[model samples]
Target: MNKLISVVAVVVGTAAALPASAQITSGSIAQNKAECQAQFRVSDLNGDNFLTPREISLFRGSMPTELSGREVIHRQDFISACYATLPQDD
Candidate 1:
C-alpha cells in the first residue's frame, strides 16, 4: 500500500540521516576534549600530571565566566564539564 511505502521511505530516510548527525556530534565532542586537554595541561602549572588544590583554584579563577562556577573537585570531572562551555574549534 502507498501508506506502507511512505512509512518505509520515512524510516529509511531517518536512518540515513542518523549517521551523519552522529559523526558531527562525535567530531564536536572530540574537539571539545582536545581543547579541554590543552586547558588541563596549562592548569597543571607544576608540570605534574595531577591537579592540586592550588592548581584547581588558579584554573577556576581563569576559566571563562560560564565555566567558572562549575564544580571542579577532580581533574576528569573538571575537563568533562569544561566541554559544555568550551567553544568548538573551527
Candidate 2:
C-alpha cells in the first residue's frame, strides 16, 4: 500500500511540474487583414484584383454576404470583411 501511494504521489507531482499549454491569441486587425489579403491574392489566379464567382467558391462561406449576388469580389471589400466574417483564434 505504501509503495503504491508513493508511485501515485510522484506521478501527480511530475504532472503538476509540467508547463501548461499556451492559449491561442486573436491576432490584431492589421495582421488579419494582411493574411486575408494574401489569401485573396493567391486565390485571384488571374491577377486582376477581382474574384469571380468561380474564385469565390474557393472561399465558400468565408466570403461576406454582400458578395452573394455580385459577379465579382473586389480586393478592398474582402479586406474589409476579414475582421468580422473570418474565424479568429478564440
Which pairs of residues collide in model 2? none
- In angstroms, the error of model 1 at 15 is 43
Per-residue CA lDDT of model 2 for 1-90, tens digit only, reads: 996586456434543443332111112222454456555554464567898887676555555565577778888877676656656788
Point out the worst 10-residue segment of candidate 1 by lDDT: 21-30
C-alpha RMSD of each candidate structure in angstroms: 17.7, 17.5
lDDT for position 62 in model 2: 50
Runs in model 1 deviating more than 4 A are 1-31, 47-49, 64-72, 87-90
lDDT of 1 by residue, 4-70 (tens): 5864564345334543322221112224555556555555555556667665564555344444544
- Give candidate 2 misplaced runs (Cα > 4 Å): 1-31, 86-90
Candidate 1 — what's its lDDT? 0.51
Q: What is the C-alpha lDDT of each candidate?
A: 0.51, 0.56
Q: How close to the true structure is residue 9 of candidate 2, measured as C-alpha lDDT?
A: 61
